[model samples]
Each structure stands twice: as structure tokens, then as C-alpha cells.
Target chain A: MSHSLQHNRRLFLGALGAGLFTTRGAFAEQLLASPALTEGPFYPDQLPLDRDNDLIIINDSLTPAVGEITHLTGKILDASGKPLKDALVEIWQCDANAVYLHTADSGPKKDQQDKNFQGYGAFTTGSTGEYRFRTIKPVPYPGRPSPHIHVKVSQKGRELVTTQLFIRDHAGNLQDGVFLGLRDILDRELVVSDFEPMKNSKMGELACEWDVVIGRTPDEREFERS
Target chain B: MRRVLALSAAVAVCLPLLNSALRAQPPGAPPQGGRGAAAPNAESFLQRLMQYDANGDGSLTLDEVKDRRLHALLNRADANEDGVVTKAELTALHQKESAAIGRQPAGFPPPGAQQPPGAGRGGPPGAQPGPGAGPGPQRRGGRAGQILPEFVQDELELSPEQREQVAELQKEVDAQLEKILTPEQRALLNQPRPGGPGGRQRPPGAGPGRPNGEIREN
Candidate 1:
């Protein structure tokens, strides 16, 4: 009887220790909040007719955009590492010809713009805090040497953060003024993501994942609002 | 008996809590906040090679390499045409190519030196640029200098004032570049071009001279 009792006590202690360890791990593993970047001159002044997650096709049209297709996926998390559901995520980027959807960018280069490219997309994270988008790989434009996608996150009718995602090791990143402006290596690392070739994907599609962590502090919330 | 029952209940409760807490952080959870950590080195040549070892068998077969361009490159390294490339074979090919590069005089390729197929198609992710193909002097440590090349600036159609501003930025970039280079390398960069500015141009239709289709405007 005593032996059985000792075994039960040991099991209880082991379970308790594991529970404590996991709780400590979760609290210790604080995610870096994504740094805010300029919205730039191109946020699609006029939203596209089809603002769906897929930027490759428009309104049942068959022809896809003229560039490498990319599947971008990620999660939205709060400061405490908990997934934030119902957060609206938006992305906008230049087309293959380096023309943005905004008039200031596409107006002059009308001939160069890719008509099929939607160029802007939005998604609302579900219970899992996960979102996905189908878009073309970004290309470098005139002033900006680095190729990038501009991202924004909003919740409860308030903007949380606006940032840019860059191709992790693109050569142009080192030269681009905006990318270099992020002097903190940690900030830069948080914004950069790898665009890897999708396994068994025909049509040369690429895939990338980048999680965004937003600050929950009242001070940061007020600052973001301003 | 009551103590044993209580201990059993505690284990049951704690077990589920531990499992749930572990599940909270899934595998490949995003990076954590801390001192800036270096981005994972996924682009190194070795890592690129290992990607073809689909079965983690430490060897690559032509059929295993799905990318046509990469398949061709590896096929060349398979000197025996046995349809498989081992680490030894790859190392041998690399040494041979390095030797060939060493023999060529700095800043010049021998006439009719065979160019690798698809060398212009941004060849793979980590393909090194051919000699004299990179814009300006070769930069070490993969840090790009010269924010905007003259061709890119011209393409922008910047106004005169904008051009002036860019020129100022270029000067600042140059100053910063000088700080990073060793005195010897700086001196090498200062050396006069062999055939002046005209010597730098790649033979017509040879290649874009820049990768990633950046200069494919026309």
C-alpha cells in the first residue's frame, strides 16, 4: 500500500513540474512586436472592385497576373503570445511592372501596369488567428530598390500597426534607404521573411510565413492611434 | 486512502494543463523578442544543395531535382553521368570552377568563355555573379552599396532637383562604403579601369549584367 502511495505522489509531482515549466516557457517567450514602417505614397487610393484575398485574378476572369505566384500566410498575435482573432489584415504591393495600384504610381505608367494584377488584398483572421493571400512576388520600383509588401493590421475599428515585409536576403535590401533606416537588427529581422519554393508546386509558386506581434500596452495603443 | 485519491486527482488535472500549454506554442512559432538575432542562413550554398536531398540521404539524383535549371547544373557535376551527385563530386566541381576563376586575370573573362546556361535568369537563389558582371566593385559580406545605379536613376526619370538629391545620397553611401572596406580594398577600387568606362560593358545580348531581371526594362 505504501509503495502505491509513493508512486502516486511521484506522478503528481512530475505533472505539476511539467505544468509549471510550460507556463514559464510561454511567459518567457515574448514575441517581438513588428516595427511600423511608412505607408508610402501608395495605399491604393481607390480600393479595387474585388478586394478579396486572391490578387491573381479579378472577378471570375480566367487570366492570372503576369508574374511569379506567391502564397503568403501568417498569424496575428498579441504581446502575450495569444492569437488575436478578428484582426483585419491588409496588403498592397506593386505589380510585375513595378507599378502600384494607386493613381500617383499607375497614372503616369498606365502602359506599364499589369491589368490583371489586383495589387491589393484584405483578410480577417478567424479563430486560429491565421490569414492567407494569393499575390504576385513584389518587384523593385524607381526610388525603392528593395522589393516589399506593405501590410496593415486593424482591430475593433482601430489601426494596430502598419509595416512592410521584405524578401529576407534580397541584395537590394542592403541599399534601400527605408530598409536601412531600420537600424535595429531585431526590427529588421522581424520584418523580413523567406520566400521559399513551394514543394511540388507547379507554375513555380512560392510560399512565405510571417507572424505579426502587436503591442497591447495602453501607452503603445495611444501612440498607434495618434 | 483519501490522500492517494487526492494525489490521483491532482495528476489528472495537471496532465491536461501541461498538454494544453505545450500545444499553445506550435512548432515553427514565429521568432521571439530579444536581442536582434541573425536571420537563419537558408541561402548558403550547402543548404541549397541539401534541399535536393529530398529523402535526407546525403545524395542527389537528377530525377530528385525538380527545378530544370538546378538539375542541369548538378548533372554537369555528375562527371560520370551515373545520374547521381555525391558530396565528393560537387566538391570536385567547385574546386575546378574556382581554379578556372583564379586563372582568369582580374576584371576580364577569356574570349568565348562558355557562360553557364540560364546565367541571366537570376540562376538559383545563391548563384554568384560572373566576373565583371556586378555593378561597380565586388562587395564583400553581401552588403549592397550604391543605393541607385545610374541606369536605375535614369529609368526613374527624376527631375533635376531629385537628381541632385540622389547624387548627394550617393556621395554619403560612398563615404559609408569607404569606412567598411580595408585600406587595400579601397586602393584596389581606386585603380583606373583597364579600358576606361567602355571596357565595363558586357558583350551585346550577353546578359542583363544584373540578376533578378532588374534591368530587363526593354
Candidate 2:
């Protein structure tokens, strides 16, 4: 089959599978809550001047970050599938060279940090509880085998959850100490999202969609707070 | 291209089936023998520094660095002031910085300290901060540093002293605004307003607290 023909078939099959999964109410009961992960120490101490959703470029600079460009989109939903609007979504990760924005991480190795990468970006959800960001595919550094993005969601001055998103089926995930910390396989499934290639994207840009489900009940919230 | 697409499609189709199968199994015991933190060594330090060798040369000139902060930092490492930072000079600077870090008290890995990969995830015990080490009792996600919007400062061409004064004035204005509103209304103001760009108004006194920014160790 030709490339475009194969792409169409994959899209059709993906749509069919999605439709089948949603219609089956049996799977609804198994919607695993997104487990909160450690907010790694590398969060930027002094944020960059450009704090927008597009991490690839900083403040109208023509140069882009050196990495596989990724278009990350997601929704903040409650456990019962209700959209939580007006929530703030934030993501931070190390640059392609494995240097983070935090002074603690990059201060000693400033030369290695990617200058173009914003390193951190934020988006606030509208009525649809949707958020989007343009960033690079995370790369693994020494000691941490799995490449991941750290995420935090807050609403109305109260924090909802802090978690990390992993690339689905990446071989490094098995070796990562933090990834293994989540003992439950279902919880692991909730955090991992596929970094699929964007159809017809000339830049080889990837698209990732990962929904974050906030715990609603007091009991669940207490569990997530850990 | 065809093979890659076919493989992705196969993985996509099999994923749901794999998920279902895994869901049926009981939770397995957590894995043991967590990987220890990789000790920082000189060879790795040189390898990381060489990434800036744009022309595949052994040394780095100021022009090779794109990051402004890095340019400034690397400029200081030029020991002989020859406008070029050679591998030996970088090694010397790294050793000096490492020695400085060694002298600091053990906790929180002070600002310039080297943090091992996965070190943040409870890997090393001594580096972890005690309760007393944290930034003292502040509001979670509270706007601590910033006060004036960047545009306002730029347009006014305010000096550093003037900026500080303006921040104080803004805080006073926020205090006055708080007095005007009822407690419930104040809480409503704190809620993020949805819509256009202008809609994101800084609430009274509540500057954009590091909402999705820094996750300070509590």
C-alpha cells in the first residue's frame, strides 16, 4: 500500500477503536485516576521572560529548540467525565541537552542548556477544559532512564494535582526509578501517552493527547495529595 | 515510511487488547534494586561541555554560545582572557565550582550543586531537605516576587528603585481593592477569568503565583 493509503487506514482503524471503547460502558468503570507524582526539584526557580504555551520558540526568536517538535494537547476532566474549565495547566522539562531551566540544574551547566527552548510554559483551560502546548519530545538524561514531562494543574488558587507524563511503551520506562515507583499498572497506563507522528506534518512534528482526571471525592483527593 | 506507519498502526491496534489483558492481572509487587545515583565524574563533565563546540573544534568561543546567560557565564571561565574557553580552562572552572559546592551544608543541594538523575525522587537520603529547610510559611502559589507587569515597567522606563516603589504602591492598591469587596466577592475575584487575552487580570494582591511553575519542596 502507498504511504497516504496506509495513513488513512490507520486513522480509520483508530477512530473505530475509539468509538468502540467509548460506547462500551464497562470500560468507564475502569477509568483510572491520574496518580500524582513527585514535583521534581528542577522546576524553574526564575522563570523565563516568555511564559506562553509555545515552548519551541521564545519571544519571537526565529530559531527553534533543537529536538523533535511535539504538539501536546489535553483536557482536565473530573472522575465522572465532567470538564473542569478555567483550570491552569503548566508543564516544565529539561532542554534537549538535558539541562533544566532551574538554576539548580542549569546554573552549573549553562552552556549545555538549549537557548531557544522556553523550558516551561502554561495554558489556562476554557469552557471545554482543554489545554495545548508546543514543546519538544523529552529526552532522557543520566540516572533517569525514562523521558517524561512534569505537569501541574490548579484552579481558583487551589492546586488540583501534580503529575508526570511518559512516552508510551518507551523502553526506558522500565528502567526509570520514578516510573517504577507507581506500583499499580493501571495508574502507569493513565500517565503514559503515545507520541504519534502528525499526519502530513512536513517538520516531522508529533502530536500527543493525554487527559488528566482530577480526583473528586475527599478520600480520593487525600490519596492524590501524597 | 510505509513500514513505520504499518508498525505504528499495529501497535495502536494491539494497545487496547494489551491494556485489557493487563487489567485482568493482579497488581504485581514493586520492582527492587532501584538504580543508584550516577556519581559525577570529570569525563562526563567534559563531554557535556563539548556540546557547544559548534565547528567540531576542541574549544568554544563566545560566539558559539546562543544562550545569553551562558555566554556571560562562559566568559568568566576564560582564564587567560584570550576570548576563547579551551577544554583545560573549562575543566579548571568545573573543578573550582565543584569544590565550592562541596563546602556547603548537606541539604537541598544549594543553588549551583549538581543533582544526579532521579535524585529528586527520594533516591539519595542526605540531600533531602528537612521541614525547617523549606521557604518559611508562605501561601501556596502566592505571587511573592513579581508585582508590576512588564509592559508597565517598560513604558514608564522605571528605575530599579522606582520599580520597587511601584510594587509597594501596587500592593497598597490591592489592599484597598480588597477592603471594597466582600469576602465572597474577594474569593470570586481570585478565580481565573476565562475568555480573551485581556481577561487574565491580576486579582487584588494575588499576582500570578507560580501556578504551574516552580514546585517548591514542602
Candidate 3:
């Protein structure tokens, strides 16, 4: 009887701890708005017919894009830490050979571009504000020092914010003019994310998670005014 | 027994709240009131395009864009198979392009000034003193003390006042660079050119990989 009573006490304590944790989490500080970054010369001029979330596979093509495949996932949250549903998140980057899906880029360097690579893709955030993209690791262009993925968040025809994610600890980052242009150290850190190896994946794939915190969407701003 | 029941009820009440709390990513400490420069936009692009569309026809043809780079842009801007590019087409392409990238395309210099072909060129970010001392990626082979070759400047259509300003700026930059360059680098800077090196050139230093160590291969 005493042992059963002890077991009940332990369960009660565990529940109490969880309840406290949940309460603390609810009161957690507001999230930061993601830093804005310049979109460089290479966004796809003619968006490919297959503009889906999985950039690696275009429609039903068997051949995936050539590079380290990254499962990039993130949440789109507002300044108040509310998940933004129905937000459109778009990402674009160069192919394995650093070729963009643009005429100015591909026109001269057609031979180098990986024809199989979709090069750009988009995803819509669900109720949870979660989004994901399957893309190759971004590589540095010939002149641009840093390897980065361009990201844009939009809603209902209005662009909320545009930024590029940098590979954290990339040596070229220090030399990248655009990266340096970001004066705030904290804001710079916000844009740089660690692309770590996804554990237990036999295929040696990579994973990265970055939460985009936007200041105020046009809708939110309008609602507040109303 | 009564206290245990009360505790159980409290836990049940908190369970739904737990889901949202659990889903919340631990908040990052965002510094209050942080500000960054807004990304480059379309107005600047039209301004540069208008300057190049010398005839002010509200449309551009290849002949007007003297720079080979700008000519490449003209081809990309010609979205319709019709060959001639209207201002509306350029604006649409620019909007899409800028929206995709977050900023204006690189290489178009600002009004009243000209930058080397690759605007982002130079030593890595945070390099000391002279950030503008190296040949851009396009001019990887450019030498030191090389003046903008006359033809390239003509292609850029620099005003007489702008040309004089550029000349003065070039001389000052060369003198400033001379103080820091090694003798070997100095020799390379002063080396005579075999052909007319392109214009608006900066005196070249050993490029990005040197002084500040490059980020090791990831």
C-alpha cells in the first residue's frame, strides 16, 4: 500500500513539473523579426514548371538535383510569437556548379548548369506555420564569396520580408560584401544557420531549421489600424 | 485524496496549454529596435535603365547598352519574342527579379557614380583600411595602378566632371594602396599592360584568400 502511495506521489510531482513548464513557456519572451538581406542577381527569371516544395525532384523526374541534399525546415512566426498560417515562403539558390536559374546566369554558363536542378521552389505554411524545402546546399558563385540561399516571405501579393540564409562559420562569409553589409552582429547571426547532418539518415542527408520572425504583416498592420 | 484530485484537475487544465507551449521554439533574444537598410528596389533600376535608354523611347535596344554586361541584361529583359524591350516588360521582370532576390540585381551602379562590374567585388568583408583596393572578380587579371581604360569609361559614358573625379579618386587610391602593398605586390601593381586593361580599375592586391584566412572548406 505504501509503495502504491509513493508511485502516486511521483506521478503527481511529474504532472506538477510539466504544468509549471507549460506555464513558463507560455509567458516566454516575444521572438525577433528576421533581419532583411539583399536578394542577389540570381532569382529564376523563368520559374520552372515544377515549382514545388521539393526542389530536388521536379515533377516526377527520377534524377534529383546534384549536391548535398538538405531538408530545410522552419516556422514562420510573427513578432508576437504567433504562427503565421497561409504564408508563402520561397527559396532560390544556385545549382551545384553555382549556376542560377536566370537567363543572365545560365545564358553564358549553360554548360555548367545542372539541368536536373529545379533551382527554386516555394512552400505555404499550414496552421502550425511550418514550412519545408528539399534543396541542395548553396554554393558560392564565382565572384560572390559566401554560399547562401535566398528566402522570401509573402502573403496575399505583398512581400513581407526577403533575406538570405548563410552557412554559419563559412570562411567566405567574412569576405562576402553582402554579409558584411549587415552591421548588427545579432541580426547577422540570425541570418546564419548551422546546416547540420541529419542523424540516423543512411543517405547522409543534411537538415537545417530556421524560424523566420516577421515584424508585421500587411494584414496584421491593417487589422491593428481597424 | 482530495488534494490529489485537485492536483489532477489542475494538470488536466494545463494539458491543452502544453501543446502550444511545447510547440513554441525557445524564443531567441531579439535586440529591441534593431534596424537594417531596406533591400534595393525597382525605382533605382528604372533610373539606371532610363539613363541608358539615351533616346528616352521608353524601350531599349541592344545598341543603346554599350557595356557587354548591360547588353547581356538587355537580352534577358527581352521577355517577348518580339526582340524589342518595353519599359513595362523591364519593370515586370525587375519586380519579379527583385522580389525573388530581395534587392536590385548587382552590377548596375548608383546614379552619379560608377562601380566596377561586380559591385560586391573587393577583399572579404571587414578587411582593414582599403576595402576597394582589389580587382573585382570580372577583372581577376587586372594590374595595380591601372587606370580605367579609355574605351570602358567611354562605354560607361562618364561625364567630363565625373571623369575628372574618377581620375582624382584613382590617384588618391593608388597612393593610399602604395603604403600597404609589399614590394612584390607593388611591382605587380606597376607592371606594364600588354593590352588595354578595362576601365574604372582599382589597383589590385593579392585577392581574397590571402591576409584574412579564407573560411576552410565546409
lDDT of 2 by residue, A1-226 (tens): 3964664454344433433443212222222346677677677899888999999999999998877889999888865567789999999997777768988767755776678889999999999999999998887643345688999888876677787899876666654546655533334556788898998999789999888877432221111122
iRMSD for each candidate structure, in the order shown: 16.1, 21.4, 20.9
How many backbone collisions does model 1 have?
A: 0
- Give candidate 3's total backbone clashes: 7
Single-chain TM-score of chain A, each candidate:
0.84, 0.84, 0.82
For each candidate, give its TM-score against the true structure: 0.49, 0.45, 0.48
Best by DockQ: 1
If both were scored by lDDT, which would come out higher, candidate 2 or candidate 3?
2
* Model 2 agreement with the true structure over B1-218: per-residue lDDT tens digits: 99999999777655543332232111111111111222233444455345456676678777765322245446657999999998777666655443332222112222322223322222223332223222222212223232544222322224334545665676687778878889898787665334211233334434223111111111
**Judged by DockQ cut-offs, is candidate 2 incorrect, acceptable, medium or high?**
incorrect
The TM-score of candidate 3 is: 0.48
Q: Whose DockQ is higher: candidate 2's or candidate 3's?
A: 3
- lDDT for each candidate structure: 0.58, 0.57, 0.56
Restricted to chain B, the TM-score per model reads 0.32, 0.33, 0.30
Write one digit per residue (lDDT tens) for candidate 3, span B1-218.
Answer: 99999999765555433322222121121221122333333443454455446566767777665322245456667888477777776666554433322221122222212221221222222211122322222232224454653223332334334456666777687778889899898887666443221212223442211111111111
Predicted candidate 3 versus true structure: per-residue lDDT over A1-226, tens digit per residue: 6964664455344433433432212312334357666556566789989899898888898987777889999888875568899999999987776567999767766776678889899999999999999988776654345678999888765576777888876655644556645433335556777788899989888998888877531111111122
RMSD, candidate 1, Å: 16.5
Candidate 2 A-chain TM-score: 0.84
